[model samples]
Target: MHGPLKGLFAWRFVVRAEDDVRHPDGRASTSLRQGVRHQDPEPIVANFILDTASPHTKVCPETLIALRYNGDMRPGQSATVIVQGVRTPCVVGRPGEANSIGAPFIVDGSLTFYFDHRLDAPVLYVDDENADLRCRAYR
Candidate 1:
């Protein structure tokens, strides 16, 4: 069987050293935010800082609360995540004391940081638009 493929692109911004500070206990930390959306009748969307080091995606408590109003979401539940037109299955978890994304969806995406004397920016590409791919941005 064959299906339509989709792709999405986004720009990345760097958090300044002053903005990226260490916790009092001595933990390296940085501020990185990205746009995330879910494919639903009333889509759940928010801007979340990307954490490549994190094995599981984390969502903000408030965001989750809002999502609950729209869809049935439990503390330990699974939801479909749409990022840059890519779909990925992710577990739902509250950020608790930490600021996090509402939908902790994970997908196979690429992030490239360009470093040049004149220009410095990072770009994120989610999902490949190859003809052979089976994933679709929309149902």
Candidate 2:
């Protein structure tokens, strides 16, 4: 197993756009598409997953807590999020829900470098300004 990420991991990246999130329970019942979801019925912000192969960001519980999106959680909840100019779908879940990384908001989806294979693991970047989320591979 890889070592745990304690400190010295945070970056700045804006939420380019919100995408269509899908889950096994079907599409999440939300109306957030493009920009941050301010009045989400259950408002949420989280660290998303990123890989050299993927182009979208994923959400984490801490991010959710940071964004304040606390409500029913379902697996396979996909969202069509955008980063830079790439539009990709983002999946959602709870702590143990499907695709659950067990780490709340490790990458806020906007920042890439989650699976760089060069570092140990992904790190969560919590920006003080507006609690913006982001991710970056360890150097």
lDDT tens digits, residue span 49-131, model 2: 22334333354333343433333335445434333233334565455321222122333433333434566555443334433
lDDT of each model, Cα atoms only?
0.38, 0.37
Candidate 1 off by > 4 Å: 1-40, 68-76, 95-107, 110-121, 126-138
Candidate 1 worst ten-residue window by lDDT? 9-18
Candidate No. with top lDDT: 1
Off by over 4 Å in 2: 1-3, 6-11, 16-30, 33-50, 53-57, 61-73, 95-139
Model 2, TM vs. native: 0.32
Please provide, for model 1 over 1-139, each residue's C-alpha lDDT reduced to its tens digit, 9 standing for 90 to 100.
0122112112222111111224569995432221222322234456455455555554444554543332324655654444344444445566552323222333344223333445433343333455115334222
